[model samples]
Target chain A: MQLTNRSKQVSNKEMTMAEKMYLPSIVQGLAITIKHFFMKKPTIQYPEVKRYLGPVFRGHHVLKRDEQGRERCTACGLCAVACPAEAISMVAAERKKGEENLYREEKYAAVYEINMLRCIFCGLCEEACPKQAVYLRHDRMVPVFLERDDIVYGKDKLVERLDDRYVRMNSEVKATPTEPSLTKAAT
Target chain B: MDLTVLLVKGLIILVIFGITLLIATYSTYAERKVAAFLQDRLGPNRAGPFGLLQPIADAGKMFFKEDFIPAQASKWLFILGPCLAMLTALMSSAVIPFGDSIRLAWDGTNYDIPMQAIEINIGVLYIFGVVSLGVYGIMVGGWASNNKFSLLGAIRAASQNISYEIALGLSLIAILMMTGSLSLRAIVNEQATFFEWNVFTQPLGFIIFLTCAFAECNRTPFDLPECETELVGGYHTEYSSMKLGFYLFAEYINMFVSSAFISSLYFGGYHYPFMNAVHDGLTGSLGEIAGHNIATAIGTVVFFAKIFFFIFFFMWVRWTIPRFRYDQLMNLGWKSLIPLSILNVVVTGAGLLYDIKYTTWLIVVVMVVLALTSNARAPKSQAAPQRA
Candidate 1:
């Protein structure tokens, strides 16, 4: 027969008289508080102030394009397939004649969408992609729009590179990262 | 006919309200700045000239933010909670003598000045009584939130505040014993020299007062009631907008109030070195009043400096210590502080009767003995039996 929740075992009871007194620890605690009262404070100010961000900041998404401006997606559907929440979806379309500069492969994603509502931002899709197309990093704040639809990125909203004033976003400003143990971007 | 006196009283109150509120708000900025500097970083440099305008901006933002009331909350109680908090925070300023009065040379009369917000003879007792009421804000806010965590937080705060109240009152009792007066102005006047300050004479009282201040303000180690880890936002969990702002602002205000009380009681309220020589003693009715007035003004500044020091002290403690366990906190207050405080009173009483000094030594001895004996009387172990 299988057991349910285990019973809580009894603990030994051998309280010392000193422990029972409780004044020493209280004074001890007071001493500690006094020591702290005299010591320096440690708080960081944000915005006008700055601190170093760690190595792995998953800030905003960047869609990598080749030097020739050709999209990097191979239309393998791996990123969509790997998304745990079914947030990503894409439609592949064959490259038109003499339009090879716009397509890195024979087939490319003509219509790609990510349901920001469903997306957990785990960066798993970036890891699962066969082609190094999708990346979530090294950008300023991920702009929050009023509507969820605005956050759900379409092919139109994807940028090949940051606008002129591109600066590397620090890890501190980045979105809260998921597990770093499996930190990778699909290539 | 008596309008002049009433007008002067109102003006003094207005000045105090403005100054204390200004100090408290700026202290918040200072707290942030100090925290930043200690952590080896630059603080707020934006929001108008070295971030002087940050507090104003913060206040504006708080005001404009959508005030959210919880569905389960008692609306009237929730609103009353923060108002009471703000009220208690500001109420303590009534008795503090800011500085010695300076003479006004108008029409060749050169009238004397008065330094206090209002000279209440029973100022110290008033402070004690008013300060205790601060807990109601926490209790009401926490209870009104109607969240289990909030209710638990309220209970913790109620117990913590009540426990610390005893130590606080006992500590003040020792001070009253030394000074033989309860008025804040009289108490400061009594401590003309640095040695005369309760800090030097009744160092035990100073220590106890300092510890109790931390507890009353709900500073670190003793901040189990509003412990953010498990209790989330604690008492103000459901509050949003300006309601939340009031709670946070009230905290800083309380810090200011505690600073004032501590300065008056222990550090000598606004009494500086060689202050009397700086302002020659008044001879005639006008002169005597003038001399005390100058002393009061100087005393006020001194008081402020001490209060700011403690405010900075509060910030320092917040960064230094993590919180205590629930049972551990209770034990510290009830079991340790109360008994030792009682003993301190007893010995202090005896010392008073015998005319014996070196209270510093006596306090140290008692502390040492308390430390040694407490270990021998340790509470029963709760270690779980080893599983096979």
Candidate 2:
């Protein structure tokens, strides 16, 4: 029934006068702290310097667009359904004939919102999307919200702009004009 | 005293006052910085460059905080507490000789101005009296609060100070025996050379004094009175705003005065190695007046440097050692330090009769032999308990 070798038997024996003095131990402790005083500090000054989060890091959410820069989402409720935190919500609207350039499909999301406070950043919504519409960006994190109202992100904040698009570093997906996906979808 | 002397004395007092406050203020910042460095972290760099303005920021915060007092607290004594603490802390620096005298010629008459606020024959006694009075501040504040915890803390502080003061005084007696004077300036002048420092002659006494100083200042390892873990802010629990600031500031001031006293008493004060050579060279090159003044200036700077080192040492020990238990603290002060200091005094007395150098060597030899014998007698390793 012997335990691990690491267990130390507590000594109840009388301490030597030297041990009782505590000066030697105090000197040893001071030496340790003085050594640490000169050692390199591992603190990273935040705001000025940031540690690199890996490519798979789930961060801020983004609503992507098609090759032609049209909204990729077809107002599908799958993401909202798949969200464990139930953070995502949207309103579907049928696309008008004149707005074909704006919507990639016959149906589009008119209003999309995600409560950042509730969203667990589990990437479940990203996995549930039929089209590659929603993704948690690896590069940027959601800025800290100051107001309660600011915690709920709307389409205006999430939608990807054509000029400055969100690109996944590890993915082969691109928005080149030579791509035939838009024509295939139209046909 | 004439008008010029009065003016000079006034100027010196003002300078000393400014310096004490300045050092106390920066000691807070330094304490934080040192604590951080020891713990391998960068502390307080945002307020200003290297957080140099952190003390100012802290003072501003203290001033703006709402002044508070417990309803059950005695209002008058509560107000008097921090004032007394601060007053006593400031008063102790008056007799410390910062440097050699500055000679001035006015109205065809020569006058010499000592770089001290006031010269008193009983400087050491004055310092001890002021330091002892410092405890009254804590006691009054704690008692006035009418809180059980505060009262306990105050009691602890009072008892701790009283206990350690004996050892501290006994340790000083060894030095006094050597120098034959209680005046701090005389003590410094006695140790005019590097090797002649009291630390060399009375190493045992220096150790005891240092330990007692740490306890008397209510620093870590002897800081049971204000220990947050047990006493919940301790003696100043009921104080708020600038009153709390005053209590905290008074501690730093006490630390400053203690460092200065330690420097002046034990470490050769303004005297440095090869000071004679430096003085001679300066005087030989420049005229006597200019050279003497410059030398004095250097000595003052050196004195300040020693004080700073001791201050840093105080913080160093704080960060290094954990606080002592109440019983352990008492045992060390009453049992260990007191007896050791008494021994130190006897040894110093004996040394004065014989050769001091021989006596010091003998003590060292005895201590080494005792340590070796103790190590040899210790059981090598107790066999591990047999498993059930």
Candidate 3:
């Protein structure tokens, strides 16, 4: 085990009478403050301005649909398995012969829920999804909630529209690039 | 005619008051900016012109802030603290000599006016009295908060003030020895030549006075009350929004007042080089000229310039140094500085007896030595540094 002696130990110690008065030390501190008076300020003016973001920035979540305007999730339980917070839940339904257009495949989610309260929004579920269905977008999706319950977003909230016009507008990730599939899915 | 003069004087006072309030506001901005720079970080640059408009923005923020009053706090005392702090901060500026006097011309006649709002003969005493009273602001605020930390902070502030007040008064007694006048204006006039500033005559006294002033103001290196680490916002912990803002504002104002006092006392308040000559020159040129009023006005400007420079210096010192421990702070004030100041007086008295010139440098050197010697700290048994 590491020793607590390191915590108590003061390295590089030798102080003069002048250092003890603390005047010169204080002066050194002042020099730094004085130096900052002329330094460049980093402030992004809000509303009228926005800072640029990198690729794969997961800001806000949106649902994605296929070219035929079908929901992308296969309801194979991939996203729910990946979610660390246990935020994603779904009731899978077996597609009948006449229900081919309702889902991308034979399985469809009869009920889907994402507990926004439990979700830390780390986007692990988005990474875990084998079907490239879930995505966490950049920017503060919304301001931190006024009510505790307001944070828990559900089925109507989580899905993204995978349409050509919608994908064109949100192609570039503003904060962090999550994965290569996000770009392909957008395309 | 007197009524007209009164009206004019009132206008000038109003203008000066406005300007001082404005300065106080901006000084807060400067304090933050300085702190930011010292820490190698950017501070408040959002409002306008590299945060030039920050004071106004801050004022807006304060006005709109949640004025929190703790349920446990004494309601009357809670309100009383910031009120006293703000009032006392503004009151001292009234006696401040802003610039040289200006002539108020009506038709063919011009009347000479004192640049200051009031020119009391006992200006120095009045200032000392007022500043000493400034302690009540912190004391009342801290006590009313009803928290143990707040009460502890108040106690610290009260004791600190009590200690430094003595040193401040004693240091000035030495300067009073040389100037022989309590009138601030007179003191400045006596040091009209740039070379004859009191800092040269009584450098030891000046250092002592300055050190004591910093202590009195509870500035860093002596700031025991709001020692953020241990106290957790100290006396003003419960104060939210504008109330806390006022307490913070008072600190800057205290710095400003100390700067003014220092400039007036030692650096020659409002007195400029060749001021007497300039007065004579102008009078000769104008045939009775605009006269002494103009000279006084010039002196006033010079005085304020010096004060602001010191204010800037105060901010500089604040950003530079960490605070002293309570024990160390008390020890320095009572033990080292007090004895050194007494020694300074004794030395100054002898030098005066001998009628020596340039002995001020000797005082400065001695003070430097004494300060250095006292700072000869003992070896620490506990290698860990505790929060001051």
Candidate 4:
């Protein structure tokens, strides 16, 4: 009839003379506290200092730019489909004539948004993006925002502001690691 | 007293009062810092660099806070309580000698300015009387609150202070028996060196006095009245704003005064090891005027160092030990500490009469054995709780 056999019997054991005196135990406790008093305090100043996040840390999403200074997203809608929280949404637009400098492809997202409140930062969107446009950047993370609307990150907040040459150099190095001469020539 | 003496005395009184107040204010900061350190965390560092201006910020906050009074509370008595607490706390410092007489040159002649506010004859008795009166503040504040918790806390505080006072007086009697004087100055003079300190002679008595002191101060381990778990802020539950600040300030002031008292009574006051030799050596090298002043300064520094150490120890114990249950506290006060202190008085008397140096050791040994055996033979109700 017993629900569980986990309960142990409580012992009403008698205390020894030393234990009864209470002085020894108090002294022992005092010694321990003093030891801690001299021990190195492990306090992080926080804002001025930060703990090193691991390499695999998944942070806020970044809508990346290609080496040619054009947006990488082709409005494939894969990232939105992969977003488990349904946080990502976008309005696909057709590229107008002479808009080749702005859009990398004929199809581009005119209005893209991610509701940060709903995002779990699981990096699934990054993995689902075929164009390598959406990435969880290691350098930047979600900032604390007061309003719910403020946390909804737009392309203006998410896009990288690196120079075109730096982007070209970085992409050349990452893409053609086997061809050192090509990367050097690209840089 | 002449005008010069009166002015000097006035100056000393003002300086001591300011220092006591400053120390009490900063002790709140120190308490948090120490507590934080013990728990491996950083305490308030935002007010100013290292939180140095925390007390000033706190004072400002308290001043601006809305002063609340319960509708059912007795307003006048509630106000009187903290004032009485603070007054009694500061009054004890009047009898405590801060340092030996400082040689001052004025009007083409030198004068010796004793570092006490008032050199009262009955220093010990004055301290006892003031301490006993302190309970009235807590009781009045609690009763005036018109709250059940406050009333309960006040009753607990009243009973605790009264019970501990007996043990406290008895323990002091042991020291008085040895010193043969009621004056704190006399007690200090008796123990003019480290070895002569009453702490060595009356270890058991010191232990008893210290335990009772914790109770008297309403510090942790004996802070049953204000214990958060049971009483919910205790006597000061209904208090708010500057009134609450006053109660807290009074507690720290009491702690500061008690530290000085303990140091004066048992730790040889301003006396250090080889103090006389150092003074004589200084005088032998430097001229008497400068040498004497320097020695006094050193002694003053040493006295303050001892007081700070005791204050730190008080905080250390507070963080280390948990509060005692009400009944256990009562039992320890009435049954154990009182009887032990009584025995301590008798033994100290007998030892002093015999003029035996080893008698203290004998008494200490006896005390240890008696305590252990007594606890072993104690009833089940009084059996020691298992330590965590």
lDDT of 1 by residue, B1-388 (tens): 2465567778889988988789878887888876665555556768898888988988899899989888888999989988888889888888877775645555565654456677888998888788889889989998888898888888888888898999888877877776788888788778888777778777776777787788888878688777889889788788888888888888888888888888877777777777767556543334654655655566566667778888887886666556779887777778767876787777777888877644655866766676567655666455545554
The best-first sequence of candidates by TM-score reads 2, 4, 3, 1
Task: For candidate 2, write residues A111-131 as lDDT tens digits.
Answer: 999999999998888888888
Of candidates 2 and 1, the better by lDDT = 2
Query: What pairs collide in candidate 2?
Result: none
Distance (Å) between predicted and true CA of B100, model 4?
0.5
- Per-model TM-score, in order, reads 0.66, 0.93, 0.75, 0.88
Q: Please state the error at residue B73 of candidate 3 in Å.
A: 7.6
> Order of all candidates by lDDT, from best down to worst?
2, 4, 3, 1
Off by over 4 Å in 4: A1-11, A76-89, A115-124, A145-152, A163-187, B106-109, B369-388
Among the numbered candidates, top DockQ falls to 2
Task: Give the TM-score (vs. native) of candidate 2.
Answer: 0.93
lDDT of 4 by residue, B1-388 (tens): 3887899899999999999999999999999989888878888898899999999999999999999999999999999988888889888799998888877677767788888898887999999999999998999999999999999999999999999999999999988878778988899988896777988888888888889898999999999889889889999999989999999999999999999999998899999999999999987898676788889889888899989998898999999999998989988889888988888878777877888533556767865787778676766553334344
Off by more than 4 A, model 2:
A1-9, A147-149, A171-187, B107-110, B355-361, B383-388
| Model 1 whole-model lDDT (C-alpha atoms) | 0.74
Query: What DockQ would you assign to candidate 1?
Result: 0.11
2 or 4, greater by lDDT = 2
Better of 3 and 4 by DockQ: 4
Candidate 1 has a TM-score of: 0.66
Chain A TM-score of candidate 4 vs. true chain A: 0.78
